[model samples]
Target: MTWNFMCLILSLFLSQFVHSLNNNTTDSLDTCLQDFAFRTLIRHRPHTGNLYNAMLPANLSGMSVSIVRLRSRRLWNRGANFCNFHIPSRTIPVPHVKRLALVYHDFGNWSSHYYTVPGYSMITPVIGFKVFDASNMMSRSVKKLSLNTMGKPIVIRFSNSTLSDGMVSKARCAIFSSNGTLHLGEITLANVCFSQDQGHFSIVVPLKRKRGQWKLWAIGIVLGIGGFILIGYVVIASVKVLKAKKIQVMEKQADEDLVLDTIWVGRSKMPSATVTRTQPTLEDGGLP
Candidate 1:
């Protein structure tokens, strides 16, 4: 009877332990599902259409973006009319996003969802005119131009859902402070040139470049190359001087040895009686 009671207690304890393990496993699975659901919602969700309501998700961080490339409307342009993303007002809208990437495929189409994650701002829309056609090569030619009387550098954020997936080949953005003329950091364009199969991507974050910047870069290169050559010349000249000094020392040593040798031969060949007779005594007592 006592043995039976002990067995019953042991069984109950084992059952409790198994139940606890099952509960833990179920909790872990639930947490994973919740995270997956959040990510999915972000990727598939659309931005609310309003110019004033630009925002980022509460879980994500925000950053500033700049115009790397700008496009303008022109005659025979094949790209779609400027795809406008209305920034909302009052509340900042968080953009639903997964990743930040630029992709290209064989299909001849531009992707509207160029930026991923939070934060989009369009300080100025594309303006101006350039004559171009809508072909593969021409598709790459239309560039964005400045918007509004070159007004105070516009600083604003853009939300996703500004355009459709296939309409936009590439997108660029820029930010400026209230003062129109003063510039901030280098502007960066998310998409530079989009090709059907591939595209030209910038290795560095694109910075705003003025027309004069090219000339400055050219001058810098020339100076750098010239400086490098000058340093090389100095090093070579130093080495040559060192080598000449070494040779001169060696020659001097040789001359001294030869003189010693001649003196020694003279001493050895002198007659034995006359060899030591000329030894000087106390400087020959010249001063005293």
Candidate 2:
């Protein structure tokens, strides 16, 4: 009966342990799934007075969105300002978009006719936009648009234009966007364009899905390799120490043998004296 009770108790403990382990594994998987479902949103605080906003298209809803701030350009003169915004190859959640657009509000006080050609009556400030995908070796150019002080926003939508993996979008004017969740109809350009003076801008990026778990896995692999190397080094060092101790023990034994040999040689070299005087005294006494 006692043995049966002990076996039952052991089985119960093992079952509880296994149940706890399974629960822990389920919790870990849930955590990973949660992290994978949502992309981290970055907030951009504009330095200039011009307001910048990003939002999803009115039609699409319930989708994860993230906005990344790209490099901005500052316009200094009437001459064309050329700048390139490259989507980093290592960006997590690869950006994939079917449609892209640039929207800007005219905020500059300068008239479009400020820079006039010699023969023409007026010349407008022309903005050119281009998208380049180096991997595919293809470049798409947007028609040059002239900007005027209309106190209203302008939307330049790219129809059937898609940004592939690792593409660069280049613009020839001052534009910017705030960091936010990228959604459909989400214009990434600044609310207002600075035709004159210094201005800041960012590109709107639409990402496919969260892919940050790969980075975590890569880190874990590196740490595991380092641990294995450390363990190997400790094992090698232990082996070397053990060999050195064995050699020391052998050397000690050799030294002891040499000392014993030296003592034996000394004892063998000692001379032995005879008792001839004692024998002659005893014979003389017996004769008397």
RMSD of each: 23.7, 25.3
Question: Model 2, stretches more than 4 Å misplaced?
Answer: 1-150, 162-248, 255-288
**Candidate 1, 71-136: lDDT as tens digits:** 222111222222221111221101211111111111001111121112333322221111111122
Error of 1 at 127 (Å): 20
Please, what are the lDDT tens digits per residue for candidate 2 over residues 66-124?
22222222111121222221222222211332222222222111212111122222111
Candidate 1 deviant stretches above 4 angstroms:
1-121, 124-208, 260-288
Clash tally, candidates in order:
29, 5
lDDT of 1 at 86: 15
Q: lDDT values of the candidates?
A: 0.29, 0.31
Error of 1 at 285 (Å): 51
